[model samples]
Target: MRLLILGGTVFLGRAVARLARASGHHVTCAARGVSGEPVAGARFVQVDRDHPAGLSALDGERFDAVVDVTRRPSHARHAVAALADRVGHWSYVSTCSVYADNATPGQRADTAKLTVPAPVEVDNPVGEHADFYGPCKVSCEDAVRDGVGPERAFICRAGLIVGPEDPSDRFPYWVARLARGGEVLAPGTPDDRVQLVDVDDLAQWLLYAAENGLAGTFDGMSAALSRSRFLAEVAAGVGRPDPELTWVEQDFLLARDVRPWTGERSLPLWLPLPEYGGFLARDVTDSLAAGLRIRPIAQTAARTLEWIRASPGDVKAGGLEPAQEAEVLREWAARQ
Candidate 1:
């Protein structure tokens, strides 16, 4: 099958491109031309998605399907329209956050709350209207359903996506923190529900959806594990004792002032109010139906540690090895 994967330089997008190529599909990747060099067999097309050049450059190219991962609702509403009449099937990468009510635990994909309606005016930015980014993604899902009706559209709503090449440093922090003997901060209750899809599983299901001609919103969740058990594996991976971890109350965490995030809100770097509401609570039974599988938690931790050790020179470096992080923790103890 011929395929086009938008944005394959990092994270899930990169995994998709590699998997597609290995499966003997003709694959091409389009991006903003910032990161990642071209893959050996696949073609790399770089065009700013907003600029006329980005959309116009692909005027002549054709594919059976286009995986719209890089798109926000504003950009996707326009981009998918270009392919609505041409592409065989359109799969939009969406977040599970699109669910109207995420604070509640154990909501299935089929739940009424999961499907957010498209806004009356999609042209306006959606993020501004939604209380959190979840609603913003809801608007994006609406655009895709608009372009290609439910029968031909695939909404791959992912839970927390973590694995190799994790650029954001969100999950990696917990992994590395436990690896080095440090006082770990438990953001919320250890048993608080958390779900994540490994990058490999995400790519596999995405390609399967495009190939099978199947279309529906699939909640892609690979594993459901508590925070305490998750980090314990990381500690074991690096040959460390299950180091001490202080389970801080959620309200206490919110009360303590922390650094600002990006150009937006100011709160705990990890538990910002808007983000905390969504991530602090999530359940993804629907994603399991989509064939999302995870390596054992212990295995996931071991591999993450392995990747960190192998890629020490990487800019996103520092996951335990070198003894530096451990030394810092020791100094903090001395000061305490």
Candidate 2:
């Protein structure tokens, strides 16, 4: 099927575009000539995705599916409105952050919390500060649903999406820190629950939904496990010392108000994972029920570390000096 993906040059967007093409689907990607070049074998549209008006370039272009990974809902609302009548399916990349609850896990679309205070105009100005990021995306989701209905549109609300080309230093920070191999300055307890979806898995599942023209919103959780075990697996992946939890106690960091990872390591596990500014969100029952699942959590995190080890440059971009990292590796090894 012919698929048009907006904002398909970076991060989650890039991953989705690549995965779709690899699966033998015709993929057309659009971005503002920023961050990436066109992927081989896929059509690339170099237009400013932030500008809803730019979308007019594709006025009557027909496609079987459209994948929107843009953060601004206004642009999405505009593009969808323009193309909704022509497209067979709309796969929106929503976030689990829309849920304002943290008390428990297993969040479904029918959950009590509805993402209120929806953005008034989905095609508002370009800057993110005023546009829909999380709450804004919630509004966009509603607009898409209203315009196309559930049967024609699918929302893939994802948890922490981690893997290669991860710009946010959140997950990579752990990989780099663990690669250092010493007493890693880790926050929170091992028992603290952690969840992150691998990029490949998320992109693949998206194609699965799009291909079948599946309706309804779905949560996207790759795997869930305690933080400590999470670190252990990462250690194995990078050939680094397992992050020995200094066990500084969550209270110590809390007392000092150390808000690393946007309190992802310490916040009530079920609440949206905010470290990546709400990218790695939580409680995605809808995502799972909609048929988006993943490999084991241990392997997922391990694969992340393994990937980082293969590419030292990527991790460095996510953190500070390489020399300091060497020192860290030394400490981690000496202890073992």
Candidate 3:
């Protein structure tokens, strides 16, 4: 089968391109080659979908399956317009963020309401992390569905895709931090739910879906696990005994101005809002039934740690700094 991966230089895109190549599919990765190089064994096409030249480069190309991991709705619309006529199946790697309700756990793909839709022609100039990310994805999904119709369109609403080569430090932060072997500051309840899909696993499943002609939306994530269990699994993957964890209350962290999810002072993989209670606990029953398989959490953690060790400089930007964590712990202890 001939495969085309849009934005195939980093993380999920790289995973799919490399895996598809190994599986004997003739693969082509189209990207600007700025973030990272395309996976080896796949043909490379330099196309910045934001520019007219990028769209022109794909004018004569054709493929059996096209996996688009674009964040910008405008880019998604452009790619659809360029390749819809030639491609056999269109797979858009969307996010769980597209859902309107993070408060409700176990909502199916069709049952959940989506966020505000963005205009297909409007580019997210503020960048991928802007507040418009989810809303724009709603539009992006629509663009693909509208372009190719539901029969040939595949939409994967993914959640917290983690594993080696992950650019986002959300899960990697815990893998590296807990590996240091100390009293780590944990956030929220011990039994708070968490779920993530390994990038390689997601990649494989995506290719499988496209190959099998499975169309329509599905939640691409694993079943939820307790937060404490998640941390312990990370420790085990790091080849260490369970490290001491100082479970901090959500209110305490909130009062001290500690943020959730990303940034330097934030605790990764935690959200205190009732609205987000189900963010990490999204239902993947349909995904799993449709051949979405997740690897063991420990294996994902170990591989992520291996990547961090290999690239120490890239590992420093995520999670709370040591001094900041210690300060928060000290204040918590004083209050006690």
Candidate 4:
């Protein structure tokens, strides 16, 4: 099979490209070539996808399948328009964030309402403006569907994708921090639910689905795990089981100005709001039925820790600093 992968130089895209090549598919990776080397065993083609003729390099080419890993709607729109005629199948790597409300549990792939007021143009959706990310993706999914027809497209509404070479560092932070063996600051309750898909698993599934002509939306995720169990698994993966976890109340953490998710002062994977109760517990029944498989959580954690150990420079980029966590812990202990 011949495959074309958009944005294959980093993370999930890189994984897909590598796996496709390993499966004996001839792979072409289209990107600007600025984000380091392309995956091994794949041909490289430079295309910005933001510019008018960015996809011109592959204008006359054809492929058995095209996997688009770009986040921008405009790029999806253009890529579909450019390759729709030549590609046999289209697989889009979308996000579960497209769901307008995860406040309700058991939200199915097709039943969940997508974010509205979709972005008309592309821009970096960050910080308080991150709401735009979902809407933009919603638009992208629609564009892909409209361009290639829904029957020819496979839309993967993915959850938090974590593993080795993860640029986000959300899961890696917990794996690396807990290995340090200390009174770690834990947010919310031990039973708080969390869900994430391993990058390799997701990459493999996307390729398999596309090659097999599977269509429609599927949540790319794993079974949920309680906070305590999740941490324990991470400890086991990192070979550190002695860390004294001090589970802190969510309200207290909020009052003390501890933020949720990523950043220097935030606790990754800790959402304290009532509206987010179902956020990490999305229903993946359809995904599982469609042959989506999740690798063991311990394996994901161990692989992530190994990557962080190898590339130690930026391990602390999106996590709490040691001193800040210590100060928060001290203050919380005093209140008790």
Weakest 10 consecutive residues of candidate 1 by summed lDDT = 260-269
Off by over 4 Å in 1: 112-132, 239-241, 251-281, 312-336
Q: Candidate 3's residue-wise lDDT over 242-316, tens digit each?
A: 789998899999999888998778898888868698798877888899999888888998998899989877654
- The CA lDDT at 322 in model 3 is 90
Question: Where does model 2 exceed 4 Å of error?
Answer: 49-52, 119-132, 262-286, 297-336
lDDT of 4 by residue, 1-336 (tens): 999998888889999988988889999999998986787789999888878568999978889999997777778888887889999999999998888887877788888887784656544456666768888888888889999998999999889989888888588889878878788999999888998899999998998898889999889998788889889888888888656899999998888788898877888988866888878998898888888988778888888888888888755477778888899899999999
lDDT scores in order: 0.66, 0.68, 0.87, 0.86
User: Candidate 4: what lDDT?
Assistant: 0.86
lDDT measured at residue 273 in model 3 versus the true structure, 0 to 100: 68
In candidate 3, which residue ranges exceed 4 Å CA deviation?
119-121, 125-129
Q: What value of lDDT does candidate 1 attain over all alpha carbons?
A: 0.66
**Model 4 ranges off by over 4 Å:** 121-129, 314-316
lDDT of 3: 0.87
Candidate 3 TM-score versus the reference: 0.96
- Give the Cα error of residue 143 in candidate 4, in Å: 0.4
How many pairs of residues collide in each model? 1, 14, 0, 0
lDDT of 2: 0.68
